[model samples]
Each structure stands twice: as C-alpha cells, then as structure tokens.
Target chain A: MSPWAWVLAAYGCAALLVGGYVWRLWCRYRHVSRVRLGEADG
Target chain B: MRPFAVGATAALLSVGLFLALWVSPPDSYQGEYVRILYVHVPAALAAYGAAAVACGASALYLWRRDLRWDFVGRAGAELAALFSGLTLLTGMLWGKPVWGVWWAWDARLVTTAVLFLLYVGCLLVRDLADDPERGRRLSAAVAVLAFLDVPVVHYSVVWFRTLHQGPSISLQGVKLAPEFLLPLAVNTLAYLALLGVLLAERARLASLEVER
Candidate 1:
C-alpha cells in the first residue's frame, strides 16, 4: 500500500468511528428525551 | 459533552492531525509508515487510560454501591474497548507495511487483544445478570480484574521477545525525535481530550437511561 493509503486508512477509520459513536449517543439521548417528554405530557 | 470541551477536542485533534501528517517528517527508517504511529500510539494510551478509569470507578462502585460510579465504569469500559479496537486496527495498518503481516502472535499484541475483549466482557456482564444490583456488583468485579491485563500489555515488549518495539516515551525519557515527539504529544493530549468528552457524554447518557 502507498503511504497515503496507510495514513488515510488509519486516520479515516479513527474519525469515522469517533463520529459514529458520538452520533449514536446523540440518537439515544434524543430517544430518551422524547420518551420523558411524552411521559411528562401524559 | 460541554461545548468548550467538544470544541477543544476538535481543535486539538485537527492541529494534531496536521502536525502528524504535514509537519512531522517521515522516519528515516520506517518512512511514511511512521505516520500510522502517530495515531496508533495515542490510541493505545487512551485505551489504557480508559481502562484505569474503569478500574477505579468499578472499585468505587463496589465500595459505595453507587449507580453514578457504575455509570462511569460502564462508560470507561466502553471507551477502553473502542480505543483498544482502534489501536489494534491501526497497529495492523502499520504492521502490514512494516512488519509484513496483518496479525502477529507477539505478546504485546496478544495481551492488548485480550485487554480489549476483557473490557468488552465487562460491559456484557452488567446486562447479562438477572438482577440489576447483582449485575452491577459482578461487572464491577470483572472490570477491576480486566484492568490487570493493562500493565501486562504495557510491559509485554520488555518482558517477552516481540515484534512490537520497546517503549519510546517513558520514565527513562522519550526516544522519539523532536519532530515526531511534538505531534505525538499533541495527539496524545487530543486523544485524552476526546476520551474525556466521550466519557462524560457516555456517563451522562447512562444516567439518562436510568432517569427516564
């Protein structure tokens, strides 16, 4: 593999994984917040 | 995570990446394969730090029987797994070009892989138990035990003959050149910052799950 290929692969994967985890957290928090909001209204 | 922390993490990571890829010259020995070390080393550091947090938090949970500590413990274990996974992946990326193999049976590599799996098991133990309280207690113990592999992983190169290189930066002083060390130091702080942000956010999310 080229140097850029190796570097890009490593950095790209790191960025994507971290971004994905953060997105998952955001989704979960929103989900729970919605449930709490519904419960509050009910 | 708080806005300031989130911003700081992004800034540090951006600057660190630039320094790693652009500013730091290629290694005379390893050439461009050296760039992988920039990310690989920091990920390992962050992984070990997360495991330590998990161990400490787990012990706290055991002592105080506090759900808050459990939240941190769970977050720590999860981050440990994530970073360890990255460490292994990036290590392989570096290794294929340098070591000529995607995987090795070396002690450092094997122990690190074990550390990753053990923390993963720590996470699972909590959900698998019949009682929540029992699960917490059991997982707390598991987390503490899983942390034992961390030191073994760290010293594995010194303790056993391995493909992995010896410690570059340690109490004995850094072996990395100034150019390499600067970005590595920056990336280390960046990863630590990222670790803090993720840990707090994950713990907060865990709290919300219980709260709702």
Candidate 2:
C-alpha cells in the first residue's frame, strides 16, 4: 500500500474507534437514565 | 458529561485533525506514514494515564469502601481498554507499511499488548464475579495489579531490543522536529480532553446504575 494509504487507514481507524466509543457511552448512559426515570415514576 | 467539556472535545479534535494532517511535515525517513504517530502515541500515553487513574481510584475504593471510587475505577479501566486498543490498531496500521508485518513479537509491542489484555481482564473480573461487592473489590484489586505493567510497557523500548523506537518526547528532551511536535502536542491534548469527558460520562452512568 502507499504511504498515504497507511496514514489514511490509521487516522480513519482512530476516528471510528473514538466515534464508536462515544456512541456506545451515550447509548448506555441513556438506557440507564431511562431505567431510573421509569423506577422514579412507577 | 457537561456541555462545555463536550464542546471542548469536538473543537480540540477538529483543530487537532487539521494540524496533524496539514501543518505537520512528512518525516524525512518515514514520509506520510509518520502521521500515524500523532494518533498512536497520544492514545498509547492516554491509555497509560487512564490505567493509572484506574489503579489510584481502585486503591481508594479498597481503603474507603466507596462505590463512587469504584465508579471512577470502572470508567478508567473501560477507557484504558478503549485507548489502548486504538493504540494497538494504529500501531499495526503503521507497522504493516514500515515493518513489513502487521504484528511483531518485539518487547515494546508485546508489553503494550499485555497491558491491553490486563486491563481488559481487570474489567471482566468485575462482571464475572458472583456477588456485586465481591466483584467490585476483586476488580479493584485486579486494577491495582494490572498497573504494574504500565511502567514496563513505557520502558520496553529502553529495557529491551525492539522494532519500536524509543520515546521521542521525554524528560530528557524531544527528538522530534518542531513542526511534528506541535501537531503531536495538539492531538495529544485533544485525546486527553476526550478521555476526561468520556471518563465523567461513564462514571455517571455507573452512578445511575445504583440509582436504578
């Protein structure tokens, strides 16, 4: 592969990992908060 | 996490990407592939910092028996896993082109991979335990022990022969050029900001688990 290809791959992987992590954190946080809210209401 | 922190992470990362890709000159030896150093080094160091946080927080939990400390410990461990995983992946991406192999059994590489697995096992020990209190305490202890590898990973290049190079930026001095160092510093700050925000968010989620 070309040097630029390697650089792009590295950066792209970093972006995906960081973005995917934030997404998962938001999902887990929202799910837990929703559960607590349901318990509080009920 | 707070809105201000969220904003800072985005802003810093955006600027970081701009500088790393554009402002930083290609290395004389490695050419464009050296760009990988920006992401790889920052994430690796951040992983080390995160593991240290895990170690410290877990020790506090053991001393005070506070779930709050456990929450932070969990956050630190999880982020340590994430950042270290990124470090390994980026390292491989850089390695394939440079080293002519995707993986190596070198000391630096092996030690870093071990650090990743140790934290991962530290996390698994928590969830796999039969009792909640036992799980918490066990994981905390695991985190403490897992941290012993961090220093070894940091010094692996210096301590043993390896395909990986020694530290470019160290207490002694920076070996990198000014142009390269500037983008690297910026990206490292961005990754650290992201780490702080994620740590707070994950810890809050752990707290909310208690509320429910």
- Any runs in candidate 1 off by more than 4 Å, and if so which? B152-175
Per-residue lDDT over B1-212 for candidate 1, one digit per residue giving the tens place of the 0 to 100 score = 39999999999999999999999999886788778888988998999899999999999999998899999998999999899999999988887887778886555567679889998898798889999889889988999998975676657655555345553322123256788889999999999999999999999999999988
Give the interface-residue alpha carbon RMSD of model 1: 1.0
Candidates in order have lDDT scores of 0.86, 0.85
Interface DockQ of candidate 1: 0.78
Candidate 1 local distance difference test against the native:
0.86
Which 10-residue span in candidate 2 chain B carries the lowest summed lDDT?
A: B165-174
DockQ per candidate: 0.78, 0.83
Query: In model 2, what is the error at residue B89, expressed in angstroms?
Result: 0.8
Most accurate candidate by lDDT: 1
At residue B38, give the lDDT of candidate 2.
93
* TM-scores for the candidates: 0.90, 0.89
lDDT of 2 by residue, B1-212 (tens): 39989998899998999998888888876678778989998998889889999999999999999999999999999889889999999989977876677876555566678889998999899989999899999999999998976676657655554245553322123268888888999999998998888888889888987877
